[model samples]
Target: MARYLLKRLALMVPTLLGILLLSFAVIQFVPGGPVEQLVYQLKGRGSGGEAAGGGSSGALYQGNKGLDPERLAQIRKDYGFDQPAPQRFWLMLKRYARFDLGESYYHHQSVTSLIVSKLPVSISLGVWTFLLTYLVAVPLGVAKAVRHGSRFDAVSTLILMLGYAIPGFVLGVVLLVLFGGGSFWQLFPLRGLTSDGWAQLSMLGKVTDYLWHLVLPVTAMVAGSFATVTVLTKNSMLEEIRKQYVLTARAKGLSETRIRYRHIFRNALIPLLTGFPEAFIGAFFTGSLLIETLFSLDGLGLLSYESVIRRDYPVVLGALFLFSIIGLVTKLLSDLCYALADPRLRFEGAPA
Candidate 1:
């Protein structure tokens, strides 16, 4: 197992390199990059008033035209564009090796600092989504399985299917329209994780306000997520109930509840466990963009999107690096979960 783990970890180096290299290449090739933006800055005609370097607006120029060739060359050299792409990539790799993600071009802040500031919102959303999903899904699925073809199962299936069909952002908009201050019921806050007066609120008030703002966003996030787990649980339980082992347990005069909970439950959990790593990491990393934007939450997902739009390469690349590492590690953790849930399972080439 240790050898297998080491081998997998070793494989991540090349995988990570490939992902970063491809991303870097794309950024380099894309137009309207840092150099062009800087030319606009120096010309002082772009939408953004001034560039990061605070270059003076000397003349109105378009697309580097009418700009001094020397100044243009100097801008390229200063931004390290003078070097070949390979050399720049290598230098970036070295900095990343030291865990130095560098500074954001637009934000004028270190990449790590920006991520740190934004992480709490994502973590909050992710945790709530994860907990709500599993806590509700697993039990709901088991109930549906046990009572298959009953009114309860039919109703829940219909509800879950409707939720699955609706996109999260769309649900968010609907939620806001119905519950936000502007509309029908006005049951929830429209944006942000807390009220402006959060710091001044009492302990209980703070908690209430936090959860109050979380309602729409969390609901939107988990709206479509429940079906997969719930359905998986129901189907797995149904399949387990029919297995010979379950029948054997019943023959031994075990109660129905004991048979279901003890023997069938453990086996049914294996397939569900396969989804754990993905759901876990996804809660933290993926699918935050539209939700965050719609609800006005500042999270890593929103930050990443902003970085791309503004061509903030440092933050963009840094976020990708961080997310990739987390994803690879989570996959390994999922394999561990599989081994734990079913000892019969083993990493390939490991001793039986």
Candidate 2:
């Protein structure tokens, strides 16, 4: 296990380098970058302020002309755009090596600071969604597997299918329209992680208010996610129930429940357990964009989206690098989870 971990960690270096290189190369060719955005903003202000203050056609045209060459050059230089792309890439790598994520071009805040500020919201949303997803999915899946072909199973399968069919964002919108401050009912807050004056609430009040605000967002996140795990669990258990060991246990006069729970469930868990790491990590990062936007939650997902639209390169690349590292680590953890779930299983180099 130690050797395997060391080998995987060593391989991550080149993998990360390749990912960074590809991303940086793409960013280099992308239009409407920081320099262009700055120039556009300047020209827009010139056109708006001057024309609104009664400037003539020639003046408006001149305002539209854009920045002087020296000013443009300076802007480019300040953004390090004047350097050759390769040099800039190398410099960026060096900075990252030293753990310096640098400052945001537009916000003027360090990329690390921006991520730190936003981490809580993402963590809150993610943790709740993760806990709720597995907590509900695993039991529900076990029940479905045990009662397959029954009325309860058929009905639940229908409900799960419907939920799986509807996208989380769409469900969020529907939920908001139904339960939010919309005309239907105002059972939930419109948008936010907490109500105003949340700090003033008592301990129980704070917990209530937090869960109150959490319901819609977490519900939305968990909506479609249930199907994958639930179905996998159901199918895995069903497969296990039909295997030779289950038949032998049943022939030995074991109670149906014992055979199902002790034998089938334990064996089925290997497939289910292996997915926990990825799902847990993913719950924190992936599939959060629209839900955050709908709920007005300022999470990492929203930050990444805004950075991309605004061409905030530092934040984008910094987040990309961090997320890539997380992804690689998650993959390793997943492998570990697999081995932990089934002791009989062995990797290529693992001791027999």
- The Cα local distance difference test for each model comes to 0.86, 0.85
Candidate 2: TM-score?
0.92
RMSD of candidate 1 to the true fold?
3.7
TM-scores for every predicted model: 0.93, 0.92
For model 1, the superposed segments whose C-alpha errors exceed 4 Å read: 48-62, 348-352
Compared with the true structure, what per-residue lDDT tens digits does model 1 show for residues 66-141?
Answer: 8888988887797778999999899999999998998888888889998999988998999999999999999999
What is the C-alpha local distance difference test score of candidate 1? Answer: 0.86
How many clashing residue pairs are found in candidate 2? Answer: 0
lDDT of 2: 0.85
Pairs that collide in candidate 1 are: none
